[model samples]
Target: MLNVKSKLQTCLLYFYFLGGTLIIEFNNDEILFLEGETGVVGIIKVAYENKMLFIATQNNEEIVQFLEKDDLIAVSNFKKDKRAIRSQAYLTREENSPLVILNKEHPSTKRLETVLSVGDRVCLNCNITPGTHPEQDVLCSCDSLSGLEISKTETGIKLNQYFDKYTIEKF
Candidate 1:
C-alpha cells in the first residue's frame, strides 16, 4: 500500500511539474494557487497547428481581447458581431492587435483598423454582479504587456452596440 501511494504521488507531482504556476483570484476574493500548473480555467486553447489566446470579460457575452498566436490581439466591443471573431476593436496594440479577420474586405475590417488601442484594462460595458468574485468569472494574466484578459462567467452585455471605452489602469 505504501509503495502504491508513493508511486501515485510521484506521478501527480510529475504532472504538476509539467504544467506551470499561476495565481488566480476567484469570486468572493477567493484565491487559488498551484505550483507547476497552467491553464486552471483553460481559457486559451493552443492546438499544435495554430494557437490563439481567448478570454471573456465581465458583462461581456463574448471574448474581450483575443491575442492571436502570432501576438496580434483583437479587441471587440460586443455590438454588431459579438464574438471576438466579429466585433470591432484595435486594442488600441500598435494601432491594432492587427485585427483578426481572414477576409480583409469584410466590413468590420475597416472599423477595426480605425478603432483605438488600450493601454490598460478596457472594461467595456461591464455589469459585474454585486457579489461576484473578481477571480471566479475572469481569466487573466498580469504578466502580459498588453492588458487583455478573459472571463469565464457570463457577464451582462448589450449586444451589437459599441460602448464607450474605459482606460486600462495599472496599479
Candidate 2:
C-alpha cells in the first residue's frame, strides 16, 4: 500500500512538471517569489523549452543545455499567465536545501494561522506542539525542542526559539 502511494506521488510529480496545469500543496510559512526578483533571476534560463526542469534555487548558476519545444511553451505560458513562483518560508533548515513550493489555500497553512492566533507554538516541520521551551509550557512529549516565542518585528509574524534545524514555526 505504501509502495502504491509512493508511485502515485511520483506520477503526480511528473505530471505536475510536464502537464499544462500545475498543482501545489500548501505548507505553513510559504512566501511567493514573483518574476523579476533576484531570487527568481535564473528560473527562466532553466524553465525554457521541453528541457528537464530541475528543482531551481536562488544560488544555482549552472547554464542549461539548449531549449526544446516544451521550453518555448513554458516561456510562452509564463508570459501569458503572469503567474508568481511560490516557495516555502522555512523557519529553520540548512541554507542549501531546495526550496519547497506550496499552495496558499492549503488546509495546513490555514490551520497554522488559526493555531498562531490562539498563542501556541508548533513545530515548523511537523505542525505539532513544540517540544519544550523556557517561556512556553511543554505541550507535547516531543523530546528535541528548545523553545518557541512570538515575534516583535513588523516584517515577520513569529520567531523561532532555537537556531537548530528543528526550529519552531512561530507564525
Candidates' TM-scores?
A: 0.17, 0.18
Tell me the whole-model lDDT of each prediction, alpha carbons only: 0.22, 0.21
Model 1 lDDT, residue 57, Cα: 33
Of candidate 1, the 10-residue stretch with the lowest lDDT total is 39-48
lDDT tens digits by residue: candidate 2, 68-95: 3211110101121223221111111212
RMSD of each: 17.9, 20.1
How many residue pairs clash in each candidate at the backbone level?
23, 8
Cα error, residue 70 of model 1, in Å, equals 14
Q: After superposition, how far is residue 31 of candidate 1 from its true place, in Å?
A: 24
What TM-score does candidate 2 reach? 0.18
lDDT of 2 at 3: 16
